[model samples]
Target: MPTFTALTTLPGQAAAEAFVEALERLEPEPTGVGIFEIEDGSGFWEVGGYFAEAPDAAALDLLAAAFGARTFVVSEVPETDWVAHVKRELAPVTAGRFFVYGSHDAGRVPEGAVALLIEAAMAFGTGHHGTTKGCLQALDRLVAAGVEARIAADIGCGTAVLAMAAARIWGHPVLASDIDPVAVEVAQANAAANGLADKVICLEAAGFDHPRLREAAPFDLIFANILKGPLVELAPDMAATCATGGHVILSGLLNDQAEAVLTAYDAAGFGLCNRVEIGEWTTLTLLKPHG
Candidate 1:
């Protein structure tokens, strides 16, 4: 069975959503349709669809023209066992004290390292991407500096890897939240796989918008490894929810975007304590002022 995808970018959220609705109505209807903000400080939104059969190019062109969107780029996705491919290609990642690996690499965990079992099929944060690795390394540095977080939260925690790491190191329950329900389920599964199900509590919420997160406010440590735009937008809320003298680790930023994120946190009463760059991504450790 072959799969096809069509992707395009439009200017506004409303327009992008409308475009998705139109996509759902097309002949050879898409198996799935999604829309997401580009998140690079660009005001554009990306709309995409997956199909079991080739989509009609003429209909796509007409929809794009009507919605003032860029022409859709359609491509056939090669049929491959993606899980098997990821298992072969993704070697275990060692970030200081944390070791991230799939079950296939179970034999490779080193002595005394905090082992995190993250299957390739999980949502994200398998520790393969520079962003996730950078964030892990930043957390390692904070522990080395004797930072103690009694209450921690991992916002936008895709697979709850960060939350699990915090739980493993500090022996405390860590709250992990993701906007997607599927990701929350994956996080829970990952936590149970690592035997940290009690320590890493997974929830479905956007940023800090859930009742559980609000009740657990004034967190001692926080992790938000989302994109630059959301990081900036989250600055004020992070400041309000974090205890004075608490710490936040942020990533999912290009090197060029680090300064803007730093400035946003600074204005929110946080001072940069450490910055780490791995490849093109930068991770920041920021502390809320005790004043």
Candidate 2:
């Protein structure tokens, strides 16, 4: 089988929309898959990610000939070659039970766990990034202590992996939220794939203010693996909604940026618990004040 590549340029907004559209329309097909996206600052975007069957060599030739000079790049690929390329290029990142694939030589995720079996895709959360793996490690450490958390929330739960993990590990109902509808869809799909749909409630909301958020009121444990600036800004709201005596895991911070984040949480009534570093990322777990 030959892989097919379709490349075209569209604006930023258009490119993003095209990517999402392509993703949603994709069905279970035996196609070699890989998505490569480049944004042309000139209000345009170039995109391509697909593998085609071999018998279509003539079709590929026609496609290439049809788009001769306008502005398109098309490539034909053999199926096996594409698969081998993706798997080999996608080094597995494991932190706890999460597995992520990204740059082969990168310390994408934290150490000390098994990689998940899910095939790598453009989707988020495979413990391959410092922020995501940091969160995974944080959850692993928490679970290792045999803690049973109930009523949890995952803010900006990209792939909903954290929420799914919580539900699987602690038998808790985890509420995962993200403002992006696409992210919500990805999270929901991932949750279902992992058999966690029953316990993980995926929602689209405007930050912590989503109506579904109320359903998870005063969560006993909250996971916020978003960036540092947003984490600081969300401190007050998280503090208010996170119950006293509960736990909060915060990541998406560089080791150097950990103190400022901790300071913000401290002011919001959380006491430092543990700070773990994996790669260049750090995840800090904070316990609500006892006094």
Q: Which candidate achieves the best TM-score against the true structure?
A: 1
Tens-digit lDDT track for model 2 on 83-189? 45665765776666655444343455456434333345543566667777788888888888776688899999888878877887777788999988998888887
TM-score for predicted model 2 compared with the true structure: 0.65
lDDT of 1: 0.93
Lowest summed lDDT across 10 adjacent residues in model 1 is found at 120-129
Worst 10 residues of 2 by lDDT: 32-41
lDDT of each: 0.93, 0.71
Off by over 4 Å in 2: 1-86, 97-118
* Error in Å for residue 215 of model 1: 1.7
- Cα RMSD (angstroms) for every candidate in the order listed: 1.4, 8.8
